[model samples]
Target: MELRSMRYFVAVAEAGTVSEAVKRVHVTQPALSRQIRLLERELRVTLFDRREGRLELSAAGRGFLPVVRDVLHRADAATAAAESLAAGRLVHLTIAASPTTLTDVVAPFLATFGPQDPLPTVQESSGPEALDRLRRGADLAIVSQQPPALWSTRTLAVLPLWAYVPRDHPWAGHETVDLDELAGQPLVVLDPTFRPRQLLDQALAEGGQALADPVECGNAQVAQALAAAGRGIAVVSDDPRFDLHGLRITQPGGDHLSITLHAAWDPGHHAAASLSALAERLEIFCRTRYPHP
Candidate 1:
């Protein structure tokens, strides 16, 4: 019945006598014998034949050996799996970010670091619904707000901002584009579905500037991918791996805006330590990838 009693029964069967197995199991002979008998009653079958102060297997016991071993194997495996996950043996980290963040900022960040970590394995997705995956339980999410809202109780941090532009669209010649220089340029933007786009739109509105025709992408990478293809200019984080030939992200208007890059986890509940280490490594990753310099 109970897993412990099953272990006791199996040990006694293997040891050939309760007197012998008690020492092996560090239990008193009487206690071990009682447990074995309890297991026999629970299973409603005689498991051992005792004669001449020795033990012999019963037909039912022999038939049940593999089944008991299997249950023990599974329980052992469950513990092993939990330990492996804690040690980062699997090295799987799931991340979600807005598309714009992915292409223009998060994309470069991952490119620079995702493949480098020992045992690093990553899964990525984006959009409001995807961020909700994190709320439900995802390892990491690269989203608009520096601190995500859906699960405020998670481990979150910030990322710096970069000025994005169309490759070879003239800003490339300049070291940086000022806010005023962007005055009349058409802006390729993240869809309003994300929070970062909301922030940009709000700032523009407060500054009393109406945007030019806003071409929207669900994520930054789509915009960045387009920019790489010479489709449009965008505002994104300035990660070191970001390319100008593909698109341009430079200092703008003598201002530095660090995007709210957040890394978070549920206060309670998470993968074992190895997986937790993966989370910590991700934090280090965001820092190295998005250094202010």
Candidate 2:
């Protein structure tokens, strides 16, 4: 039988009378009665015992009541889930970013969302990997440089590259150092897998300069720590948290080297509204804290 007939059967079963159920279901008594009769005929069992101008559930109707209620409840739940998905309120947003970006940008951006709002899941990966995860259905990605043509992006901030030097180092006294000045220095560098490191390598190659047997780390914090210990100068993003008294940060070649942070997402994602909201909040935070000059 149709779900509609099942619902009519339930209403009549619950209300215990045809007239009462018809009023509750907003259907004519004849239509409700006809559907109930059809359901009973289809099931090949009497659903109700009619006597003394009142209706009572038969044994079979009592057995079927709970089953029909369960089906309707499950169907309603499925419909609600679909609606939630359409409204961008159901899925857990996945944001992929580099470790530095995760610490500096993504974490803070997430804090701006209300406690009641759905929290996003953070995925730390290299720049290319972050975009790759986005391509593979991640809800958002934070990366350096512009996104590919297929993805939509919002530029969050333009961050200058800085040289972290030990207090006793000769370059510590200088506010900035030329690109040539970094040549042959014992430097602490992030792993070449990182996009920032690749950009720095490209610039150094173009200028015909290179670090002298650099110390390598997977992330900037470790590189900064190594620099603080006087192992070597560290090249890192200009985050104030990484600035220590013993470690002075200097711009490289007076802002000749810098990177722009961007939030990217597939425009065709089903949760476009959620992605847009996240990007807007991140952009606002970046503008307030790291506004480009």
Candidate 3:
């Protein structure tokens, strides 16, 4: 019949006495006994053998114990799943980030959650695509520029631009290079759709220099690889994961150019609360990992 009645039956069967079952089920002995009797009546089968002041399971009770246990287990599991979903703990979040941030920022943030917690799905794209993913129902988007004024956004980190020069290059000997000095140097840059490229272009414009025919790569690691191979200098965010073994990282001199990263989500989305919480965590993680000067 009812789950409560089934629970009472199981408790009494396991405890071997109505008195013992009451202690476990936290009901009066009479109330528990009534439930067991009601259950047996409903099933039209004798559930327990009571003799010599001890109770033992009857054939019917033995057969039903396992079934009742399974039912209770399933019910409990279903309840827990429902509660988790309502709390937003079980939602499968989709996070969109540029490839460099996915490695340098999102990966480390994920590491702190431990293996037991469900991980968010990551979508690696350039800034524009990442933002587009957010608009199309991604839970969060991590990008180098703030989202448009209408979107909900949290500033995560501000990173300075760094130049990766081939180890054999003359600039490798210096700690930093000026923007003017890099003028006319073939540059390995992220695709124009990415924010870092826009920032680099703006900085170059301000410095009265320009990259006439830069080698464009889809992501930061590729740009680094191209620079390492001496194709051009890679200008990117100061992400440590970019392999610098065959390159020297140089900071831009004077009014160093920087990019601000933000986590953005659509405010009207159903997961807005969860996404906002995720954005907050990302901001805290980025601040701890890359503290602003």
Candidate 4:
């Protein structure tokens, strides 16, 4: 029933064992375990099932997890809002986005803020978790996915997915390379959580093609590094790094392999108008900065 108990339950659920959960929650193993038991007894539902000394979420636990997470997020948001209000600035904002988007788009946009403008905080969130960050207190979420109904969203830009390679590579001189040809090569690609990977998966499925022995990396810089070392072409949407040349990915249908960035926010937020205006400015900035060749 207490918030601390909920925190302990979530920590145990994520860590999978009391020993590990104690390290995260900074509590003794016995205390954490007792708190979880008390929580389950109060709710009259077992939240976890112990099997082979491992703690796995029970059916009831899985159902209750989201509700608990939402509660914690709102609680955290309330704290942040109160702190911001106490500082005499109610216009503070937070943006949630992938690391690549944070570096390439949001950071640059923030650099244009003047003295009178409020500086926002940034949270590194992947494409799939962008909207969830809103519940976690982010004022804006920039991602490639379209948000559900009642959320305000705007198309920021359609950015090309690039195949990066060394300058000496055969594709270096070309402005574009077909997805089929790229798939045939041993490629370095980002993980499935990235927006570029999602788009790549869809394009490969539509073309009935599959990557051959592609090396999967979790970060764009690492993927580009592997490609630079002659590992293979790096398929990503990040800006060029490590002196690599990026070629646009083209499909057989003549359209480029690309991901459209969307700026999403809760329409009911207090700063909804400010977020919308910022999104519009970002759209204009992207259009001018990354104009089609």
Clashes of each: 28, 0, 0, 0
Tell me the tens digit of each residue's lDDT in model 4 across 120-211. 89999986588888876788999887877768999999899999999999878899998887888888998887778878988999888776
Worst 10 residues of 4 by lDDT: 82-91
Query: How much does candidate 2 score in TM-score?
Result: 0.64
Q: Is candidate 2 or candidate 3 better by lDDT?
A: 2
lDDT of each: 0.60, 0.77, 0.76, 0.87
- Per residue, candidate 1 scores C-alpha lDDT tens digits across 1-293 of 78888788778888998888887789899899888888888889999998899888899999998788768756654564575567756444556655445555445555655453433323455445555655434555655454554443323246544456545566666655555445466666777755656656666675687667877887565666666666666655433233743222223344444455555444433444544565566556656654555
Query: Higher TM-score: candidate 2 or 4?
Result: 4
Off by over 4 Å in 4: 22-34, 37-46, 49-54, 58-60, 80-92, 110-123, 178-186, 191-193, 204-213, 252-254
| TM-score of predicted structure 3 | 0.62
Candidate 2 lDDT, 103-171, residue by residue in tens: 987787778777546657889887678898765446788888788888988888887677777666776
Q: Ranking under TM-score, best-scoring first?
A: 4, 2, 3, 1
Q: RMSD of each candidate?
A: 16.4, 17.3, 17.6, 3.5
What lDDT score goes with residue 182 in model 2?
71
